[model samples]
Target: MTTIRTVTGHDSAGASTIISHGPLPGCEEFIHSPGFSAALVWRTPPQARIVDHPGDPAQAESVIPAPGGSSALLVTFPPDDLAGGADFDPLAAAEELCQRLPGLGERFEAEAPGFHRTDTIDYGVVLDGEITLELDDGRTSMLRQGDIVVQMGTRHAWRNRGNTPARLLFVLIGAQRPPRGD
Candidate 1:
């Protein structure tokens, strides 16, 4: 479980206040298999904007917000040895996620050629254990504790080659692509 401390400012006094501080009510847990589990920490609305007064700024949902919104999530991937024979369905999972999160289905690939791409910039940090980021071009990068990765809308996948669960924190921000001709 992860704890999130949210701070806000008061409109009248302009003083910082700890609005809510604690673990999330519950995480959107996705059980890819018996051992692999992923959780969505929190999500913001498409039109989210900071306000002067304290109020609800982040709408609760486990999906990509509009093209300018963002979301944060925590994922724990089981070791490849354990997950090797696990029954996993990436397409089904992606379909379910797209149904819950608008615009996500468009980026999902049932047969993504071992990689999936989304039109969003992502910031991923290794929180515990280790994992590998594999690209469609056959290149891979190992990420360990405290390491960070900035993924720009590219085809990729996260793989846990180690013998332990790999935990990661990822923040995805929606972005716009330049016009086709530009």
Candidate 2:
């Protein structure tokens, strides 16, 4: 299984009371693993969360945080072929992603080889190089730096045309919502 690592992000997160919300239902609070670990928790409502880190200024990214309710968390999954991947279907996962992340932008088709996602809202910012976006009408768009894209139900794909590897901050949200207060 191929392993995907995360780079150390912003530093100095003081002890503050930030609401812990997730894209999925029954998720409310969050806690730090230890030593203010970078582990982001998905807690049920009412109960708050505690954070702990290993004293290391750098921490691996756990989950993409979002607002509460349908726009609570940004679900991210490794490429289907990645090792120990979230094993989440891209398309089907989109519905849940939409409910989790709100005020989303547009989605485009990526031309990344080994692409596999069914029913998932795939949204992300292109990091480096260029990637192609496939549309439902069989149309395609070239996504470069500073361009944001979102995908749902429609068939799409990603292709990395740059020799140097490119990275992205991607999120999977739900489009269709379940019964109220679910």
Candidate 3:
């Protein structure tokens, strides 16, 4: 867990102060595979924009209602997780997430080849190790530390090719698809 410091305005002081500093509140950790895990860092509800304030301290506890919302998460993929070997269960992790997060279950399709698309613009940064991002078109890219990917509602999957666990920080923001027949 990462320590999150929250700063807010001090009454009658006209200065900002650290009101809270510690691990994220209400953070949920999910172990998908043997070495793969995901932690929900925070989430913002829809229907309005954030105001100029410290925001909700318990906001992290709110589960994402749907795809058209904002969320930040940390995902770790273990090596050989996507190799499709005898030990690897490809759908096990997805199924687990789908069961826990209703939004994920809504996007997942039974017939898809482990490839799913979401109505969100995802900004993913490789925090450690290396990972391969594969798209539905068979194109793939190897991302290392400091690499950033702008995933625009694309159908994709992640695989860790390195011996170490690959950690990625993703900030997904809600997006609306273009109207049909345009």
Task: Provide the TM-score for each candidate, comma-separated.
Answer: 0.73, 0.37, 0.72
Question: On residues 1-182, what C-alpha lDDT tens digit does candidate 2 reach at each position?
Answer: 12233322233565443232223331322121110001122211222233332222112131322222111222222222331135535454443333333222113223542234433454667755555665555577877777888765355655444443334455444344345597
Q: Please report the TM-score between candidate 1 and the true structure.
A: 0.73
Candidate 1, residue 75: CA error in Å? Answer: 2.1
Q: Which stretch of 10 consecutive residues in model 2 shows the poorest summed lDDT?
A: 30-39
Ordered list by TM-score, greatest first:
1, 3, 2
For residues 81-104, what per-residue lDDT tens digits would candidate 3 score against the true structure?
443456655578667766555465
**What's the lDDT for all of these models?**
0.68, 0.37, 0.68
Measured by TM-score, the strongest candidate is 1
Off by over 4 Å in 3: 1-14, 25-32, 46-69, 81-95
Native-to-model Cα distance after best TM-score fit, residue 107 in candidate 3, in Å = 2.2
